[model samples]
Target: MSVIFTRRSVRSYLPKPVEDDKIERILRAGFQAPSAHNKQPWEFLLVSDREDLKAIAGMSPWAGMVEKAPLAIACCADTERSKFDDSEGAWWVQDLSAATENILLQIEEEGLGGVWLGWYPDMERVKIFSARFALPSHIVPVSMIALGYPAHPHRPADRYDASRVHYGRWGVSWEESRSGA
Candidate 1:
């Protein structure tokens, strides 16, 4: 829980390579995430070469410092298994979202830092990453997670607000229920 709470968006990283064992642990955690209908359509592509990372960074300037990170994993989704009522549908995005969250949390737990670079939300990134990797038509590039040892520590944030929690219905905050209201 401390890892989940302290997890922050780390945009920069130290020049240290992440150990394969730690990466395995993180990927294992991701694979453990629940998927709708047990249709696990996620595939991870690990990229560790500095030149490859540089190419990725060049494709997306927002990921400039990500080139310095020693490891990155491209989250790809297989559209074949995901169906909306027995037809080719787009339900894979939600399933992939759950998986992505698991990966992010796992990275934090593994004492590594990472940032989820959006690829699905933006068409530009989709084209860029897909063309770079030569992704198949059925596979969608969801995002790239830049991972490495943290160059700086993340300060804990108090973003949770008690007032934001509503019980049962709109605006009847959870705080009201604890007092038997």
Candidate 2:
């Protein structure tokens, strides 16, 4: 719970490289995420090369931090492993998102800093990343996580909002429901 509350999107990182064991643990956490209909469609691409990282940083305006981070993991979805095959069959997106969140949480637990960079739905970024990594047509890049030792400490903010939480219905607040109003 501390890890969940303390996790923050870290954009700045130190120059030191992250250890391989930490990387493995992070990946393992991603693999442990729950999937839709037990269809785990996630695949990871590790990019540590300075040149490649710079290239990735250029792929999106929000991804400039990748250029400085020692490691970046591209979380992808294997379309062939998806549960369905129609235009509305985007459950893989949710699965990949869960995996990405798990990875970020594990990064925080590992005492490292990390940020999630969106890639899917942006056709230009997706195409560039696919071509750069030579990913198969079935493999869709979902998110990129840039991680390493933190350049500075990140303090967590309490984001809990009771107003945003409904009890049994959309308009029924928790207090209203509790009081049987």
Candidate 3:
């Protein structure tokens, strides 16, 4: 719970490199995320090359922080491994999302800061990154995370709202439910 409350999106980073062990731990945590049918279809591309990071940052409008960060992890979805039917491979998105959340949480635990740069469902952004990384056809770029020591401090947002929670039934608000209890 402390980790969840302390996690925040960090865009500004100091000019410091992240230790390899910490990055590996974060990636390991990501793979621990649950997936549908236990089909873990996530592949991570760890980028430490300065030029590559800069180019990737330029690829996304919201990912300028990547250029300054010492490392970036491109979260990719492997279509071949993911289950698919008539509808598109929707399960992969959920699986990747869970993995991404785990990575972010692990970053906080490592005393490092990171920001998730969304790209999936945006065909143009996906295509750009895929081309830049020379990704194979089976792998689809879902999101990128810029990670490093934070240049500025950030506080976690209090997003909880009791009013938004319903108990027992759909229309029974928390207040009413508590009164009954």
Candidate 4:
């Protein structure tokens, strides 16, 4: 819970490199994520090369931070291992989402910071990643996470809202129950 509340999407990073052990722990957390039918249809590609990072940063407008990050992990989906056929119908996206979240939480635990850069639904970006990384046809790039020592301080946000909570029925507000109405 502490990790969940403290996790922040850190964009700016220091030049210091991340420890190999921390990276391993983050990947381990990602692998532990739940998947549909226990298919575990995910493959992680770790990028530490300066040239490769710069090239990948060019893949998306929102991923410019990848150039500065000490490490970048390409979160990919293995369609061959997944149960669904086409990329559109595959449950791999949900599985990968859970994995990504777990990775972020673990990053927070490691005292590092990172941001999730989306790519999967965008075919052009996916094609670029595949071509650049020489990913096999069975693997589809889903997201890229840029990680490093944070240049900024951690600030957690509390997003809970009672108004959004419903008791049982669709419109039965939690407020009504609390007020004994």
Candidate 5:
């Protein structure tokens, strides 16, 4: 619960770098996420260089933090291993998302901050990353997250939206369910 309340998508971070031990823990937590048939098809790519971070930040709007954050982790999925029926593929993106969330939680627990930046839909960036990292053709880069000690204290986020909840039908109110309280 503490982690739940504290885990915020920090877009800015201090210039100091994160400890190597914490990176190990974050990777461990990411791998601990359950995968379909235990495929565990995720690969982590850590970037700590200023120049490389700047190049990547140029690719995505929400990724400017990559330039400032001390470290960035690329969550890539080995799409080839996502297959279950011995011949083809499955939903590896879902599996990778699970791992990403695990990393986010671990980030907060370890006193670090982060933001999940989307990249899966951007084909151009993928190509750039593929060549830059010398990744296998079968591997697909899904997302990147910036990590570091936060410069600001993040407040708990309320994901709640009362009007969006319905009792049964499209317009039916869930408010009645809480009646007689």
Candidate 6:
């Protein structure tokens, strides 16, 4: 729970590189995420090369932090591994999203700072990433995580808003639900 509360999007990072064991643990956490129909259509691309990291930063406007981070993991979806073929095939998006969240949580537990950079749904960024890494047509890049030691300390934000939480139905506030009204 501490990890969940303290996990913040860290854009600035120290120059130190992340350890291999920590990296392995983070990847393992991602693999442990739940998926629809047990499809588990996630693939990871590790980018550590300085030149490639810089190139990735240029690929997306919000990804400049990738250039300085010691490691970046591209959480991708292998469309061929999806469970459905029709409109439901898009379930891979949710699977990858869950995996990405797990990875970010693990990063926080590892005492590292990281940020999830959106990639998928942006056709230009996706195309650039695919061409740069030579990814197959079935492989779709979902998110890029830039991670390393923290350059600055960040405080946890308490965003628990009861007003946004509806109890049995829409507009039924938690207080009303508790009072059985």
Model 3, 17-38: lDDT tens digits are 9998999999999999999888
What candidate 4 gets wrong by more than 4 Å, as runs, is 84-88
Candidate 3 stretches with Cα past 4 Å from truth are 84-88
Candidate 4 weakest lDDT stretch, 10 residues: 81-90
Q: What's the best-to-worst order under TM-score?
A: 6, 2, 4, 3, 1, 5
| lDDT digits (tens) for residues 21-91 of candidate 1 | 99998898778878778889888889988898898898776888667889889888888766546655576
Compare candidates 1 and 6 on TM-score and give the better one: 6
C-alpha lDDT of all candidate models, in order: 0.84, 0.95, 0.90, 0.93, 0.87, 0.94
- Worst lDDT run of 10 residues, candidate 1, spans 81-90
Q: Write the per-residue lDDT of candidate 2 for residues 1-181, one digit (tens) a residue.
A: 7899999999999999999999999999999999988889999999999999999999999999999999999999998888564445788999999999999999999999999999998989999999999999989999999999999999999999878889877977997677887
* Steric clash count of candidate 3: 0
Worst 10 residues of 5 by lDDT: 83-92
Which tens-of-lDDT digit does each residue in 1-181 have in candidate 4? 7999999899999999999899999999999999988889999999999999999899999999999889999999999888744345679999999999999999999999999999999999999999999999889988889999999998899999988899988879989898998
RMSD per candidate (Å) reads 1.8, 1.6, 1.7, 2.0, 2.3, 1.4
How does residue 82 of candidate 1 score in lDDT? 65
Q: Say which prediction, candidate 4 or candidate 5, comes out ahead on TM-score.
A: 4
Query: What's model 2's lDDT at 100?
Result: 98
TM-score, model 1 to reference: 0.91
lDDT of 5 by residue, 1-181 (tens): 6797779999888888899899999999999999888899999999988998898888777688888889989999998788787646547788899999999999999998999988786888888888888989889889898989999989988787887898878877688567832
